[model samples]
Target: MPTLLTRQRWQLLTCLALLLALAAGIGLRAPTPPDEPRFVLAARAMVETGQWLLPHRGSELYAEKPPVFMWIQAATYQVIGNWNLAFLLPSLLAGLATLWLSWDLARRLWNRRIAWWAMLALASCLQFGLMAKRAQIDMVLVALTTLSLWALLRHLLERPNTRLLWVAGFAAGLGTVTKGVGFLPLLVLLPWALWRWKVQLRPGAALPRARSLLWLIPAFLLGTAVWLGPLGIALLNDPSPELQGYARELLFKQTGTRYANAWHHVQPAWYYLQVIATLWLPGSLLLPALLPGWWRRLRRGDSRYWLLLGWALLVLLFFTASPGKREVYIFPMLPALCVAAAPLLPGLLRRPGPRWLLLAYVLVLGAAALGIGAQLLGDGAWAHAQLARRGMPETLLPVLGAWLLGFGIVVLLLAAWLRQRRAGMLAVLTAVLLWNLHGWGLMPALGPYSSSSALMQQVGERIGPSAELGALAWREQNLLQADRPVTDFGFKRPWDEQWHDAGPWLAQAPHNRWLLVLEQAISPCVDRAQAVMIGSANRNRWWLVPGTAWNAACHAELSKDAAAGVDDGD
Candidate 1:
């Protein structure tokens, strides 16, 4: 009884739901990364104090990223006390928004088949998929970038709606708040390039005339005003100005000097080439072929093609110039790559002869999987050594092996499906979704981190809900996510285990029993206590309670350290 349109709509909906379900399932239970704990700390600070303009770490105003993720995470934390859930949910939702936007963009430029493949391909990617699971700003960056592209394309090809342009600008502003001001300038180039290309050919088909430049004014103000507006007002109103004294330290010193002057870590330019190649599995290589094809169409007045192309290029350029490079920095480009590649998939599938390029990509993916599996399996001439000393059971080994086998099977299946031109939509979608679920979803969960999860759960029970906990010398945020109030005891560099300054707070804590989650090699201050083996006892005990006789020397050492001035107050 369903019409063809209704069927197609239902199919699209089903695919979307499957993608969301996979993302949510994988993300919800996954361990929070080290960086996530920092975000939670910031968010907790935000909620406790109603200063949306300034990002804080406890009482100190922390100058890292703008307050976007902190605000959202804090808001989410208000509903759910679980900081991991708060951080994970917003990013996960952002990823879902990206998928939906990619599908809609692809559908407009190409066919439904390509749209389905594009969305699935994007959702399946290891890097993007993992980002969705992690509580970070990268997912939000991608979502904003994707939405801006969608709006820019709509403006260029369809009607030049003022609302869309303004919205795009606002999204870019929001993205700036989320991350830094990386891709904000690309707004001008996107629609401008489209208009220029159209103008060179014929006047009638061109984008909104030169008068449309008026939109940029409101766009800039609105985009920046969301966060900076409040910041400016706060700075102006301060009687005892904290920002005024450190004006140089806050702005140019941190952003410009940190990257350009090489005050931080630097890698070779070729670093990102390697990052993009393997971070997202085998499909990442497809970008080289996809870029040129998309460019040709874009130059020929295919609005979406060029808009995405511009956005993707801008992201790459932004990160390439940035000295503060990390694997996740290029995340904004993934959705654009998906959009660029999707249009070509149907044609590639319909081709008679087997595409060598496609096979090559699959083989590369398989090789990457094999290499990773080798590293994980541990040291040996054949098997190689990895986390072997952790004494992980042999039963867990097959999880990686099974993943490799599945990757191989998917390559063959996709190749066969492409050759026969059958299950074109369903096959690609299934392959991408499955790959994402396994590679990004299962892989992060099944590693040493999973063992840590077990440890945290046991520790959480012993520590109780109200016990005051502190990370003595641990970097694992997952342990912090356990339902307990945990603080850092300043075990990190420059401030080594400052328990003296932290002593007053420890004494003031409601619970007498202190849980010390120490790193593998380091030993906590000795006394009476039983440790619940979270992952492995020797490996690093979880749910560990320290004795009444805490080490006085350790506290003295921490107190004398110059950097430990903030104490447990920090």
Candidate 2:
């Protein structure tokens, strides 16, 4: 047993533990709202329509993002033949790759011990764990960004290896194609130049020539060309205004305009400071101790810390400058921070202060979980109200409460057994346990309500097989989970326009045709007495409208709104 705990064995065990934690709840739930369903719907369309170059949502082209992530999903689905598993696999694989890259980079920069610490720190981060388990593009983008950073660091610090330089360029290019910010890793050049000017180089170490760096342009271009090249040709060859509009929107508006003046999710400059404190928690709790030490190193002109910390700061500043902000935008910088902090974690963990903090954090988390669980089980009014508001069945309250109680009890007991002496280990254990319970128990329980699967299922049952369904102001989840074919008025089109189109469709076959209309989207012309209320999902009430519910008088109103270009809602 002692022999089994060898260094190699421990590393393997760490990886296996990470995998198990990340893979816990996959396939148990369908894709939920905000972003998951949209991506999956696009991927499914790709597989079904054989239209790999462009992604379509219902009838409209989805130009908000590049097709690379969708392509990965489509490819994964083709091989596995399971949408649930396939949609999530890319993020999982990207997460594992990210962990491996962080481990390897730390080992190369410092040693095996530090590598272990880096991987563990990154894995234990709440944001990292959250992104890893979801089918999101940010995780994949993080993986690519980390890969570019890893290669760039090696090339700049270790040796002037051209191949590594090309690797860095290509990865960033791929990162750009994945999402526009892929070129962020190249920002390291500024710090690298500053370090060269400020610090003395070790014997036989020298910076690469200016000309050698030029290779990055082509490499990066090659990466973007993977998606852009095809898109450009398609746009040029086909004179269709829709494709041209998609190209223009994707190339310019989505990338630059959105960043410069974000129309949604706007936040103040200091918002990320709050995000870094909370979302990056447990790991972020160490910052108070780590920052001073890092500053000391920077003051002494330590090039390693300069490069890693400097690049991370630049990435933060870059995102902070943007009007549009999201926590995941800075996720790529996490690996670099973990690597820089890894060598110091072992020392920090030995100190009593960090240990007590970790212990306290664990206790608070466990207590919160326990308290929330007890509240639900005791028929707390707040708990029941929350459940009802989310469209979750009241029957699930006991089961959810039991699961939370079990998690809390186990976590609290483990913290007690480990005490402060092994609080660092306790922290990792707590994270694993929390994620496992979330994935295996909590997420699956929330699946029906969260994914709108229950709502769609109920819609199917009420309408019967013969009824044709059309949707007004429909979400991606509604279309994805529908039992049969669904006709959706354009997703981005105005609610009035959608109502204009849906009214006539419902009027076509009043007896057999039904319309699933959003409560807000249902115009005053529709008769509420005839429309049946469908349960809420995704925070919106839906109504099943028969042809009898449609007032033909409303058509004149809808036409006037459409002709006037009066956009009521998105």
Candidate 3:
């Protein structure tokens, strides 16, 4: 077995390597997450109006979420002045920060071996890597949740310090601001309190002293009051009928009741299982083998391990119970699950005679890389030939080839390294992190959403500064801003308001030359001339130059599509 310093040295190296991998992923391309455009547009609206509390875009009420995400977006935009990178930078930082916290937590609980494995597992995972680079609230939630968990676990293991509890409270509060009230401080604290209560009942166990509970009151007040208070006062002072409908639909019904009612019933419980299988990929397979050992440790009175276990379960359950489910929901749970599974790697590689576990991982990942690489290569070659004919540099070919070859090389190296006991463990962790950073972190930002920047510039060239623009979907509103338009369509959660309401407002305004943005799926139904397809990230979005009587044309086209059985793949 590797000594503590030896393991620490390796872990430190792995951390640095993973950081580079993630950095490469971050730097190679600038792609904003899907929601980033919406948030950026809303932040711009804030900057324009000097109304921080009431987020808006033109006539639309843009308060689907609390302002924390928008605030981050606004800050990024304020500094970088580039919408895509600004929106992505915060989430990227959050992802990296979460990885660091996972290492710290792992060190506290088990040892350097487990910590390194856990961080590697997390950094390599498609789930975590992808979400961390996304322009969503999930990364922030993951970081804050991990910080809260680390603080709570630290308090539980050694002493019940009030300062740690306060920090935990602050983290929980911030986590609540990031996502909602479900996962962070609430589900997290409840389990710890109950477990601690049980410990107090034990004969010789020292109950958590009275001082430990003291932080809860201030944390509760400070966390809840800061955001909710201002929102309430703003609503009370100048209550718009628009905000009323929005508040009911977004803050309350959509997030709360819609789940039980099957509103956005995305998938069954098995949906997440499938997502976990693919998203977690090779390392995900090891979880079943690793859980037993960690479970036994927790059961045997290791409170730190217990806390981590509880953290993973609570995050998993939070998403599972939510009515709307998606693959990204499992992202925050990755760090904890990875750490818990880390300890088993050393034994699994050596004891299994090295043929089964490692070979299986390499073979599976290798096949997957080959399949994906083949498609990318064909596309790149065709693109390169076309670019050469057009007398361009055709630079993208080498970059594409390098990525594909790098992925293959990492897979091969990990397989060979795993054959030796010492090298096997190190290679697995290191390779997983590098591959994940490349595959998820680098690819999505570079490939899918990166095209948005070009689209923004192209649209900016065509549109005049005075033209009023509206987005059919709230998401592409940032694209309009990126195009340097003075006024934009509103940000609404359901996004139905723009196609339904904002279209008419822009047409009626003095600004007649209007650019309306719509997703490609919605384009055929938008009966507007001068519509151009921008780019395909997760989905395709478009900007439309609406004619006079735009709303009527839009509705007529939509009705025609409805009759023709054309849906937005709804």
The CA lDDT of each predicted structure is 0.61, 0.89, 0.61
lDDT of 1 at 101: 93
Error of 3 at 400 (Å): 2.9
- 201-242 in candidate 3: lDDT tens per residue? 446644466566667667755665657677778678867886
The lDDT, on a scale of 0 to 1, for candidate 2 is 0.89
* Clash count in backbone of candidate 2: 0
What candidate 2 gets wrong by more than 4 Å, as runs, is 1-5, 556-570
Give the Å error, residue 29, model 1: 1.3
What are the models' TM-scores? 0.75, 0.96, 0.78
Task: Return the lDDT, model 2, position 160.
Answer: 83
Best by lDDT: 2
Tens-digit lDDT string for candidate 2 (1-570): 677579678777867877899999899999987789899999999999999999988888888889899999999999999999999999999999999999999998888889989999998889999999898899999999999999999887777888988899999999899889999999999998888898887777666776788889999998889998998898789989888898888899898988998887799999898888898879889999999999998988878899999999999999999998988898998999999999899999999999999999999999999999998789799988888787788998898999999999999999989999998889998989988998998989988898999999999999999999998878889999999999988878877777778888888889999999877677777898999998899677899999878888765454444333322111
> Once superposed on the true structure, which residue ranges of model 3 sit more than 4 Å away at CA?
1-12, 25-30, 57-59, 79-85, 182-185, 188-205, 209-211, 298-302, 353-355, 379-402, 417-451, 460-482, 486-570
